[model samples]
Target: MSAENGTPETPAGSTPPTGPRPEPIRFFGTSWVGHDHGYTARRIALAAGSLAAAAVACLVLCLAYQGLQIADIGSFVTLLVVVMFAVCSALAFRHTWAGFSSRPDPDRQASLRGLLTIGFIGSLLAYAFRCLIEAPGEKLHRTEYEAARARHEKRTTRRSGNPKKRRRP
Candidate 1:
């Protein structure tokens, strides 16, 4: 109705149109947007819980190793078992940590399933470590969600007031 395109213009004091709501992250609900509603407490609890679980798992593994020793298993075989677990754990930790920020190759992930399964403790440790710093995958999800919101806003914005009112060539 202004001296521009025929479509009615929004009042200057009115709020802009909102984009779609963000998808919530697990255990975070929608609190990640503002870091409110017990977000900090949940992060602390999860971090401590995961760390404790990982510690307990390690203790059980240690006890198993001791049983191997007490069984008079060959020293060479015991050492090999320890080395294999250590290497596998290291690899699993790296993979799990990297996965928080990026999507891993499915083929590679499938190939590593056995190794990862054998090194579950490492994955737990990685989760605990990341939770201590920030909610697991929070940053990655926040960035992607924000980008999607921005794209939605851009796409929905009225670029032209009325296409039908344009002059023909």
Candidate 2:
């Protein structure tokens, strides 16, 4: 039987469809519900800025709590934690943009990874903390972005360098 829209309708007696629900698309913990590169970039950059701000705020709070005194044991410990998270977050942010690019930036990635390694060595605790949130997502996005980019490059190069165009007069 056909419905008012001229499309066939499933019989009422038939079993309903069953499958897993689609996962919601999210950017930086915020659901986009739609894809737009500009919006995505803005959200990603904002997250980076927020992390940097958190690092500065931590330093300020630590100082205030100590009545603006010199570095002590507690302050030193706080510095390590704050620096670790801040540095990692900054690297993650830079890598996020690199991940989004059509071409991968190996040098940038290497440098950032180096910084992350240093931070990890300095404070394993904070590095672990930031990695818990950033690493998996970054890796997944980077892979997906690179694969799509490679495909695009392959298609364009084949199209732009046609055999007909290479014929000499």
TM-score for predicted model 1 compared with the true structure: 0.80
Model 1 lDDT tens row, 39-151 = 78988998899899989989999999999999998999999989988999899999999998987899999999999988888899999899888788888878888898889
| Pairs of residues clashing in candidate 1 | none
What is the C-alpha local distance difference test score of candidate 1?
A: 0.83
- Output the number of the TM-score-best candidate: 1
List lDDT for all candidates, in order.
0.83, 0.48
User: What number of clashing residue pairs does each candidate have, in the order they appear?
Assistant: 0, 0
TM-score of each candidate?
0.80, 0.27
Tens digit per residue, CA lDDT, model 2, 1-169: 1322222245779975432222222333212223333445544555565556556655665675575244455767767666665677566555443443335567865766766553332233333333444432444555564676677667666765567769797
